[model samples]
Target: MSWIRFGRCLVAALLLLGAAGVGSAAVAPLTPDKKVERGGELTASREEFHLVVAKLLKDQGFLDKNNTFKKGTKMHRLFESYLQETLSDPAVMDFLYTSLKENAEHVTDFDAFGKALAGEYAVRGLTRLSESDFQELLRVMNVLADRLPVRDCAGMLRPGSAFDYHWLELLPLDDARVYLRLTKQALVAEITRSPRIAANTKEQTSVAYQALYAEIRRRLAPEKLERFGKIWGKPEAAGDEELCWGYRVLLSGILDLPVEPRRWMLREYANLLRPPQ
Candidate 1:
């Protein structure tokens, strides 16, 4: 099956299981302060933002370590599935944009601003995600804070690049979407170029990898894909472990996953393709 198809099937299965209360705890939804403005510039402190996000996640049963959903849930899987789906979904993205834009006034810390926006949306009926999905949402928020221009809680063309302060008043959802698409495309290309992704000696593995790579490449701009291919062909990216590590580094950079977890995931994936001793 195509990766997209596989992903849809997987999400459907997970949602079905979650709906059935399969290994899920009967957790109550959080009740945020009704006084908090639902449609205004986010002025919450960073600590307040973190507290809200944590509370919402906990309320959704995301912090339940004993849940069956944690098993086999890698950061990359979460990114590829939940984060990708959320970012690509027009309805979800539109909701996110509207929430952020409504709360975009008086925001000084972009990190806190974005989380508060997400938390606000979660409390307002965006909490239908699985535990893994919640985790991905949090991770994606972190990545956006780190990579996107957010000087003084304002989106920018680049660091130190000045623009009309009035323009910063509006939420840059269009730019945010473009950024997400580019990042996802780069991640897909990087994963496709990983040597550890397929067994070199297995024809079936080779064919599958090629087909998957072609599909991902087909979605990317020709010039962008060409640039990525050149980078992948470099000597430093040429070996099983090297390419694996390269892919891990790329993912870590984009997804904001900690080094130790990303390293462990790469090792686990490599072992799956490794020959028996």
Candidate 2:
């Protein structure tokens, strides 16, 4: 059966077991055993359990748009149903309780317990994840990426293309030029630092760095190249405060480039640039 279908059936079976009071004599509370005294109030774990149940119901769309877990709300009814039909099942409750209690000590609250359960479920679910599950995950990730304020520029910048100058238009022209230069330098540095290239003789290494940097520089605007030379021509530019910060941000983005084609492309470029024996 599909995982979601199996999950629903398991939940239904547990509900039937709960209704029949199976293992009722050995039933256990889903919360930690200890209680804290404060203003004669409910323990934090109890409060957290209510909040967690409410959140789960809301996330699952079991709650009405305007409904909350107030005393008389539909959300509250759903939560009650969950408690009676699922949490009350001795097998379900005991499994969750034992899983959390055994793996985590700070799970004294229901929120912590819920998070712990989620982590455990995720790990176990991986064993059953199918190709469709992976595709769905990718779909969801794409949707989320599209909604993010910052655009995902993954794979947009090719090795021989001028870095997209439009992305840096918000900065001063000089700053933009510096950013582009630093970004290229960072890329070259990364290419040379690769163990495949770095293990070579010093002359071979220098040739590789120069060949890669030359290819990249050939693609950039002449003005940008001029600005780069004007600033970085001096040895002190390597330690320049502003350039260093820009280099870090640009290098971080390069380092985080998607591993698939980009990594393979870099390896290819390194091989092609290496001096022949």
Candidate that would win on lDDT: 1
lDDT of 1 by residue, 1-277 (tens): 5544442342232222222111111111222333245444545543454466445444424434312234454322332333434333334444444444465555444445554444333322212322233334324333433443344222221123222212211324443333333333322322233233222344433343344344445555777555444434452334433333323233333233334333333232233323232
lDDT of 2 at 137: 26
Per-residue lDDT tens digits for candidate 2, residues 37-142, read: 2222334453454455445444434333222245553234443443344443334444454445454544446544453353333222221223233223223323
| Candidate 1 Cα deviation (angstroms), residue 242 | 48
TM-score each candidate.
Answer: 0.21, 0.25
Clashing residue pairs in candidate 2, if any? none
Error of 1 at 238 (Å): 56
